[model samples]
Target chain A: MTGRVIVITSGKGGVGKTTTSANIGTALAKAGYKVVLIDTDLGLRNLDLLLGLENRIVYTIVDVIEERCKLKQALVKDKKNPNLSLLAAAQTRDKTAVNAEQLKSICDTLKEENDFVLVDCPAGIEQGFQNAVAGASEAIVVTTPEMSAIRDADRIIGLLEAKEEITSYKLLLNRVRPSLIKSNEMMSVDDVVEILSCPLVGIIPEDTGIITSTNKGEPIVNDEAALAGKAYRNVAQRILGEEVPFLDLDEPKGFMAKIKNAFAKLKAKV
Target chain B: MEKGFVENGFIIDLSDAKNTTQLVFELSSVMEHPEVKRKNVCLKLGALDLKQSQLLSIKALIESMDANLAFIDTDSEQTEASAVSLGIIVSEISDNLEPSIVCSAAEEVKDEEVVIKTECEVVEEDKTVEVHADLNSNANPIETAEGIEDIYDEQSTQELSEIIPAEHFEANFEALAESEGLIKAEEASKYILLDTGDVLPEGAEENDTNTETLPTLYINQTLRSGQTVSYEGNILIIGDAHPGSEIVAGGDITVWGILGGIAHAGSLGNVTSKVRALKLNAIQLRIAGLYARRNDTLNVPYVQKTNEFTPEEAQIEDGKIVIYKKLRRD
Candidate 1:
């Protein structure tokens, strides 16, 4: 079966595109599909570090396109999943070294073997971003609910639609606060999707553990307790043709119950 | 490559094809290969500006070869031009593939169109799901995993373990911000705003033992509800502070957008601090040791009764923080 290539991108930095790519790749591979996540950030390559595969990236995407190594040679298998691999971006090379055509060729080569190929696009609408999107069959635009990020996402959506890539585009809202939404403090997922006019693929709540995990070069999906982790996993499932409902981040928590649970956990640890 | 031969018919001639063996192999391969099917497979000979004619020929070749003939090329001008002609429009090819896949992938209990019909149903189901979330006010996020697992019961837990189970979080008090909400502290102001400047409080020292050095927090996004920002220094919110979000700074707080959230400036006991926003409708306002809340009573015209409107009038005169509709007219 031919594999699908999905590019995870966000025009703004720190909006969680790399995180989505890593988690979705892992989630898909865990679901039994052979998956390869490519970091196309080049100079700011972080997918390898995010997946903790930096040490295993024998060759980088740059090396493969430059003919220094084969595509398979550059694929670093996730120590956790033999089926999950990472094609790390070169640390020193700039996005100029490659073009969209080169990326398309690279993705084509991977499609012949893997079930899913996810490209972690660089932040910005520059050449690097172009090269990253050039090869992918579909796109996952990641953004936060903040108006600034949402506005950027809207710009991206407009570009993709203008380019006629809208049909294949999906949205992943990160760092969302449902409680804020209920209280009319933050934008609701519905409001975001309505504004972007795109299909909602995932909703990732802001989790501090994500920061800790990033510091450790581990994706939050590795932590089952993190809501963002499940959200990403659900995103992967959706990509695999499964229908999953979005979770409500704005639901009011039973304050007293939460306090009780907080005490329970404290008591348990003791 | 495709030029008209018999008035209405087209022909492609490969007279000078004898130049390269690789070209010969490629020509024969396109003609004879079963999977590499094509119509009017022909070559041409001439001063052929390989850039112009070869590019056209490759386009004709791909069009004739297969609807989805994925192209591969090196940096040669002709090849580059050929690739460009196809426009290598990434999304188009992918979208053309989805319908067929969606059709086959769709589990039809009835007819093939059942899939399309189900698509609508699925959306409706999504709406209901959201409605359900609304009804289940205190739905523990962890329970979602149990529901998901139950949906796919055949799969074992070993199959889908995550590194951080946010759905099944064991909340920590210090980490309460992460769970309850993230409070990014705003920046404090350099100079404090004093309502009663007559006499300093008994322990009113800007640099007192109780005072903590405040850090500058430059918040870039609208602080939405459930998001609280607390800092030891001044807070500068570049975006709107949503009604539900609160910013507590040890110094001063300034918002670029409408500030509807709670703002506490000089929480570290800096009595002279102030809070400012483009539009302020904070649920609770605190500065230094003073705190105030909007009064629901006394039909004080929502609109300004008179000209004066300052933080001083908004402060507590007697024991309670004062909420003056219009600066007490004389």
Candidate 2:
């Protein structure tokens, strides 16, 4: 069966591009759909570490492009999922080793067997970003509520619109904290969506468990109790043509907050 | 025709060099030898053409090593024209000429042509890297290997086979600033070896060619990310090697500052070559056929510019890569 080729990118660094790719790819595999995560960050690769498959990598994408190994040989199977595999990037090599055409050919070949092929792009709009977006039919623009992130996302969307291959594009708003937004300290989710003027796929709440999961080399989505994990799972379902509502992150917990909420609603009616 | 006589000179034969990179790399590696510091260098460029800019760079590179370009012999018409325009002499040495050494492999030289001989050739041309080294008219380095090893007494290979299999190793690195006693056991387990078997190049024979005998390439600049420095002999860096950078040497690698990249020592299969840095923070350490990586718990991104440096050294011992942490001063 043919697979859907999607590229997850962020124009700025440390905006959760690799983390999103690992979590969504795992969520899809857990749903029984075969997925392949291709890390296009050549010299500064972190996807393999996030998936806890660093020690198992014998060959990388550069080896495949250089004809030192077959494409299948370079694909390292995930530790938990049989259907999910990783085509890791060479940590010792740079972006100049693989050109856009070679990455396109690799994506073309990978989409034939897998149900979803997610490309984890490096930061910046230079050669690395161009190589990552060369063969994708869909794009996931990951951004935070900060002004710098929205500005870069807008620029990326403009570039994606110019490419004929990108049939659709959606925005993934990450690291959202409801308390900060309510206190007027951070940007609201609606402000980000309005600024970018792009359709939203999912909103990932700010969770402390993400840091622990990253250090443990386990994706946050695997933690069933994490709000960010549930949010990422909703995103995977939405990718599969299902309608999943956004999480109401502003809803306050605790007994005193429930009474306060009732009084606030009654006062609004008057 | 008889050529003008010159003293204290060397004829570097680059006739087999396939490209400019190979030519420059081979030339730089040999030129850094202390013996060739003041010697004039004569290059033999084969059929390969050289642009004026490329020739200028090569000339500048040779001058950087405190050597002079005496002349060059080239077969390519384009190279001759380029050398003539750059005011470089393009002429061949006649058979009647007398010098202390001759590297030209011609059918005409029949008499006592060479008083000096090549001290290199242990490095096989695997993935392209083989060149005749700088010649000295006086000393044979092979006989002096033992004496040179004595100079590096603290850095000696002390029972290398026993260092790896041991549960704990006594800290043996004597600090250059102060010689302190043994301290911690956890300091020696910095890198964990990989299980990949027999990673040596095809048809590569294991040998302990004295790394002291090989020439060194001294680099004085900070190596940024994505940059690589590969040499056929020992390499000494005066600055830091940033993450994402790679330094591949055919012999020992020494860095005066932090080494945060991948270092491949003895790339041609000389297991005795060592990798040492002011701060041994390499992401991956490779010695000859063995490979090891930093512990995952200590894999945090390298940052912070601190003045404190605990110099460490890594070498192949007992078929496993072992690290020795220098003692810290109280």
Candidate 3:
């Protein structure tokens, strides 16, 4: 069964690209589909650390491209998920170590055995981004609810449009604070979706659990109690062509806000 | 009954050990203490008979912990033969050497000279005590339990140094200063060592060709991330090796500043080659074919600078990269 190649990227750094790749790949694996997560950010790879498989990465993608080891040997199996494995990038090498063709060939070879091959692209649209996007036919552009992140996402989407290999691309709005949006201090989800002019794949709310989970080397998706984890799982469901609705992140918090939210909902109905 | 106090040396009494495994376990557990990082260790092995390989592993285990196995106090004749073959100092603990050892099994393997233990216990210099007794049958046999107590009763610590053979110091490096007092570069990494390019290809045989005879390459500039310097011989850098940089040398690598990158020495498998730095904070320390990544707990994210630098050295011994914190220059 050939897998769909999806590159998870953000033009700006610190936009949760790696986290999105990790959580979505894990969510797919938990759904009983074999998934491969490839980290193409050489010299600054962190996908393995997020999955807690850093120690198990003996050989990296560079080893595969250099032919020092076979591609199968370099695939580090996730500690908890048997169906999910990672192709880690070499932390010591830069983007020039493995070019676009080599990564594309690796992704091509890996797709034959898995249901989804998710490429975690490094920030920027330079050689690293081109190399990451080379392996995949679809893309998920991760953007935070800020002007700078949206601007970068637009640049990434424009780049994706020029490449014929990227048949489709979707946007993932990350770190959306509902209270901030309610107070007009942050951008609303609809505003980002409208500005990017791209279809939405996921909207992950800002959760304190993400920090602890990242440090613990466990993905937030594994924690069922976490709101962000549930949101990521819904994102995975939507990726599987299921019509999962976006999470209602704008829940009222205090008693006064609850009364105001009820009036706003009624006003929307009216 | 581990009563052993020699200056910069520890006398471990493993007489309580029932078997070889337990002895090594207890020895390694005690070696974990900061005090045992670099010191001479004398083992008191009881009646358990150990083969040559087992004895070698025990020696390697001690050496891996940065301690040298100075000698073994054994009761088994087979053990004594194994120790002698391995060039390990085989000493018969005098019945009344230290006021600490209270055992009956020790007096059985007495040698001609009651020299080793007396000197090891009294030497004031750190791990400089070397007592060499010529392998001779215990000429004077005493069947009575208390018969040998009076032979060395009057022998003081100063007079015991007289019997230390002068030739033994250079005879063997079985238990010497080279490996003693080393802090282990603690890493639980896999054994696989990766090569970047044609740089030290895999499955190569180890040749301990002296590194001093090889040519040297010196760089006075700082190495940033992704930059690499590989040399056929020794490589000397006067500046810091940043976190992502790599330094590969056929022989030795000496960095005058912080080494926060990966430093591989004896890259082609010269086990004697070493990696030294003013501050050895390398992400990974590799020697010969061995590699040790810094434990994540000690892995700091950013490069730190300070005026005071406690230089450290890493070298391969007993198939492990043991780091040594060098003495400060006043």
TM-score for each of the candidates: 0.43, 0.61, 0.60
Residue range B213-260, candidate 3, lDDT tens digits: 777776767898768899777887767898767899988888878998
Please give the ranking of all candidate structures by DockQ, highest first, separated by commas: 3, 2, 1
lDDT of 1 by residue, A150-224 (tens): 888887777666664335998998988766776898988888889888888888898888877776667788788
Model 3 C-alpha lDDT per residue in residues A92-161, reported as the tens digit of each score: 7889998999989999999999999999999999999999999899999999999999999999999999
Question: Which DockQ value does candidate 2 get?
Answer: 0.13
Model 3: how far residue B134 lies from native, Å:
57
* Model 3 residue A220 distance off true place after TM-score fit, in angstroms: 3.3
Tens digit of per-residue lDDT, candidate 2, span A117-161: 999999999999999999899999999999998899999999999
Number of backbone collisions per candidate, in order? 44, 0, 1
Q: Considering lDDT, where higher is better, how would the candidates rank from best to worst?
A: 2, 3, 1
Q: Which pairs clash in model 2?
A: none
Native contact recovery (fnat) for each candidate is 0.00, 0.17, 0.23
lDDT of 2: 0.77
Ranking of candidates on TM-score, top first = 2, 3, 1
Give a tens-digit lDDT track for model 1, residues B1-330. 212111111123333444444454455554443423433222333333344454545555556555222323232445445446656311110101223323333333222232234343332332211111221244222101012213223223322212222122112211332222323222121112223222223454443322223445555666665477777766766556654356877666766556655577766666645565545566457666654543322111112222122222132233333332212111
Worst 10 residues of 1 chain B by lDDT: B89-98
TM-score of chain B as predicted in candidate 3: 0.42
